[model samples]
Target: MKFAPSWDPTTAIAQQRRDAMLVRLRELRALEQRAVDRSAEARPVFDKRGQLLPRERVGLLLDPGEPFLPLCTLAGYQQDTREAASSIPGGGMVAGIGFVRGTRCMVVASDSGIDAGAIQPMGLEKILRLQEIALENRLPFVHLVESAGANLMRYRVEGFVQGGALFRNLARLSAAGIPVITVQHGSGTAGGAYMPGLSDIVIMVRGRSRAFLAGPPLLKAATGEVATEEELGGAEMHTAVSGLGEYLAEDDRHALGIAREVVASLGWQQERAKLESDPDKDVLLTLMPANLREPVDLREVMVRLVDGGELLEFKPAYGAATVCAQGRIAGHAVGFIGNNGPIDVAGANKATHFIQWMCQLGHAIVYLQNTTGYIVGRDSEQAGMIKHGSKMIQAVTNATVPQLTIQCGASFGAGNYGMCGRAYAPRFLFSWPSARTAVMGGEQAARTMQIVNEAALARKGQRPDPVQAKLQFDQIVEVFESQADAFHTSGLLLDDGVIDPRQTRAVLAFCLDTIAEAQTRQLRPLQFGVARM
Candidate 1:
């Protein structure tokens, strides 16, 4: 009698429905598995430290709850069935509009899964379109590049060629004054390096990335010397020697984080208002040592000068001689450049690039002077110090943005000019009583005067008189005094007077507010287009 209950039609129907549902579920699971397998096959490369994929890196850079508007979803150009196989969304390069730190940004990430994220015709188109969008919308552009090289397969298929188009597009983006950042995640070789090189800021992940105009094989064939990828071009080599990239990140995630912070420091175009913050109380004077001979850490001063401990230092490892950063003063973004007093040619070039990039972003510039001069000797010349120094000066002089100069210590010769001296047309030039502005330091001056005194005594056929020598020395000291006093006494340098070291932050805040209030000119409108390549 109990077994008879299971014979109902309703029970039989329920069993059938369950069977059908299980079959459909199995089919969906199988489809999902196939998709995952395909995706893995496409992306063979993984982050050495985090093992994160390019898509995952993009996700990390974007703000939560914000969706991306994809670019070049249909970049593959094969008309026939077989060619369409390689045609995927994003055309091997994933590009789109996304939010980073609540600010709209145009982003392009090369997907290593597809053709090793090579530069295909379609992919180039996508990049150009994204660049256009960034310029038109006044949004910051972030590039995540990981490519083998230009795709030769596209040329075989149909209409495809490569030339100066990419460079031209980069130039346009630069001229348009949009902040462009590039991240070299993995194997940025050949033409791959150029894109990142042209960007305002280049970030590389240690071990997981390498950037060079040529790969090992090509370099070996050309130079007849075998080398490893790191030996030829790695994070340490670029950041410390070439200064091509601004920062060396521990991983892809760290690189994205750095990019986000940098963008936030630049602020948004719509806001236009300068970033402002409270002055660090009494911290500036305490940062420097009492003895002038003892070297002081410039970073300590930077930490005290900026707001929220927010200082976007550029080429930090490259130029130990000068320090450059973007910081907020009274709610306004300002570029800060100071003497590191122990940097190389690479560091100087980095400083130049940082200033140029900041000017392009429309931020005000501040120069904190304390430098000996350009690195001297044969090794420096070999490193192209003259060329790089000239470039740095060019960037400083040509910058259209407002500039402020603060002579923290000794500012000698060309170093003073590079630090935005009066000749550079700075909006305001302030100095502390401890400031020394001259063509050279006192020791160099003493030597030069001694040499002149010796020549004069030799001509007169007598040793230089001690009394006269003392007077001459006193005169030289007075000359130095006059030059040093210009920042305090002359109205040309400051409207009020020399500020105390403790008031550096407050002075900057006041200057930023004044500039923002006085600047009523509208920004020039930018035109948009695909990069020529």
Candidate 2:
């Protein structure tokens, strides 16, 4: 029998704080959901135009009741700065991994209801990452594309340049034997025309879909040429005359039906054996203290995750703070690196060794993150913390195996770097609802700045102003705390998404299966992508 983690529920102040954290997490999620609803609900104009909302189109494209693991819903969040009231409607796209006619594929839709589905700077980043995921996983890419092209008035030169890669990736997917299917539900002029242009199969909705290199107004302005919407790039012209669209649908629903049929015709079959569930998985909720101020044992969390709660710890005593262990999640072999406390020189070295070992074994690696950071002090500095920490980071960065990170709490400082934080580009990254990430703790950051201020005052031959210093410190703390929370990081698209603690095991297993399937599947690589001719 696998040993179960000793259950200990927080009480008094700890319980009070944890409860507050839960409330805040819910509030942030509610705010994000409001943005989603706003995209679908506030868009009455779609109904007037006799069209479905972006989300509705996504729903119709997927198999009913199938799981949809939505990615990067909160991308480019506060980065926009103008509309901080609600999130930016999923960075202008509705995308996820789901089933269509029993074939697993990546489904994407432009949230045209918002800003006419103009791909924002962050929207561009989100699509780039999504395309990369689809390519990496060897999954068919399906897009419900209806973009108004890039926002010309708000355009950035860098974004314009980077946007070209989107079309290139579409072609790459087809060349890699991963089919690219697109449903053109509306305008796709200028740069957006390539979304359907580069796809292996294209379905155009009659009377709605349009794909022109330049719209009529732009053509008239740039040249003496004159053309109507229909004459330029209408569905009928593309389907019957231009050979741009392989199939033409009467409406949005019909377009989605044809897309599903395209998936069915692919002849792909995926057999998944359901991992045995933990009868007492209710523990996923109660394992970590709601407040990151309290201590957590990653081992305790790990035991509950792996099969039979059995794990083989690697080098337990040398660097006790940083933990390396081996276990099986859903019967898939996994190597885990977790934190019980700060990582020191010894811990970094241990992690470096463990990471290299996992790479040699060709196994998947999981990071259970929770640390204030790598240890700092004069004594630690001389001990080569930087060198060893660099080695650890280097190992994580170059590991040949698939790596996934779960932010449980306090993903702060170089600890975040050493633990394969978002910047490290793990195949999949997620955070628990209460997880907090920053360069350091809010108090720590404030104190460091306060000391600097005091030193400056001392040099000016004045006594340290305690009151003035306290006010400044408090302001700094507030800024750090607000931005470090999981909601904020997720809003910034640091991780894939903020998931409920209860879903960690299932999420981990699903991703493992995805990586495994990709590894085993065969692809026919071609020198060039399939041309529309």
Candidate 3:
């Protein structure tokens, strides 16, 4: 039987909650737009150089009108800035999944409009995340390279150490046979030169492109050598004498055109036989209750997400609180695990078995996280909650098939770890606007601390001051509550992005398709990445 919603959608309370969610979504979109606007402010400078802006270059590189799912648009949000209100997002780069010459690829463009595309600390993390995605999905990496290199004023030793991973990923991508493509639009100095050096394919724009281990100033400082910028690392010299660039263009537009042609020439389109599919009318018709605290059936969500609104539940009678099922989404088979309440010992064991079963079947796993936590207290401990929970976590960590997570609701304590939390490195993780993540609920944490403090006071033969105790409790609650907000966590790059609850199916389908494509595609691995002679 198809699951049905239990709550009335037309109620005023539901509408108000949805409105609040929409408001938060709008704020997210506005911040994303602000990054674009901040980058656009450099258009005049770009125009003077006869160069297209970063977004414009990305637009030209991507196929016209095909969906582009921008990743980490708020990566550096409120990070590397003094105040949240004045913070610029996008991490000095625009990166996403988009079609290039009809082939889906990971695209990254340096937002040189801001700070000459200097690498912010979070920006480094953002690129590392993108590289990880491209590698995991076996997607071609297309980078529009331009930067002033690292900002010396903001340099940190840790950041310097972390920067090595960026180049290492480039080498890894090439070694894995996933193509590494670079478009050298401007400066790439010092260690940055490795970008083009490590790529399988390099396209450079004449006069503008620069890639050298040391610029004139550094060279002069080290060896007292005098040389012009052109003599050091100009595109003309690299393409002619150094043989570092295979394709050279006159301008930004011409360079992008070459890059597109190169991608189209890869013959990367290998289509999988289409399976008969169910329409999404049922999914669209269902609306999740706006009040996040209210209990709702996990089945209601499963029916809306799976193909034909059907699911074959696995071990339903046992560990009823932990729902496990097999379902198809967009014609691809997948296993889903969702929570209805705190996981008991039985629930943990049930989930562990289900995870291994799915891996054996070679189906990807989708985790719908909505658990308060694993069951706590004396009875649960004796029943082996710790060991059972550990088994589930172990199963999740070693599952051969891809795993994806959606923070649909409360993700607290070790429950998050068992459900493939961000720390466990799910292939992709997204959060709903209503989702909240923390070690425990704010009230519970406050109460726990109060109990501890009161006991300590009693040992000292002192009675707690009622007013002061209340104030302390309030402060603790505020700390946890503010940090647990989905928006706040999202701003901190805790998930891929905060998405509308209604768009969960679409997002899942897109991610599944990406993984399927990678599995089927053939690659040519090499002992080493391509190198400039």
Give the alpha-carbon lDDT of every model: 0.65, 0.86, 0.86
Error of 3 at 265 (Å): 2.0
lDDT of 3 by residue, 1-533 (tens): 23444555556765665676677678878888888898889889999999999999999999996767788777877666647678888789999988898898999999999999898888898899999999999999999999988999998999989899999999999998889999999999987898899898999999999999999999999999999888999999999989889998999999999999999988896553433353543332223444456765677677778877778888888999999988888888999999988999999999999999999999999999999889999999999999999999999999999999998889999999999999999999998777789999898999999999999999999999999999999999998987887767766788888777777787888888889998888888888866666
Among all windows of 10 consecutive residues in model 3, the one with the lowest summed lDDT is 280-289
TM-score of 1: 0.44
Task: Measure candidate 1: CA RMSD.
Answer: 29.9
Better of 1 and 3 by TM-score: 3
TM-scores for the candidates:
0.44, 0.94, 0.94
Task: Give the per-residue lDDT of model 1 (tens digit) for 448-529.
Answer: 8988889988998989888888788777876665555423222222222345566677667755654564353233424642
By summed lDDT, the worst window of 10 consecutive residues in model 1 runs over 1-10
Candidate achieving the largest lDDT: 3
State, as a TM-score between 0 and 1, how close model 2 is to the true structure. Answer: 0.94
Candidate 1 wrong stretches, greater than 4 Å: 1-38, 42-49, 77-87, 153-163, 269-533
Model 3: lDDT to the true structure: 0.86
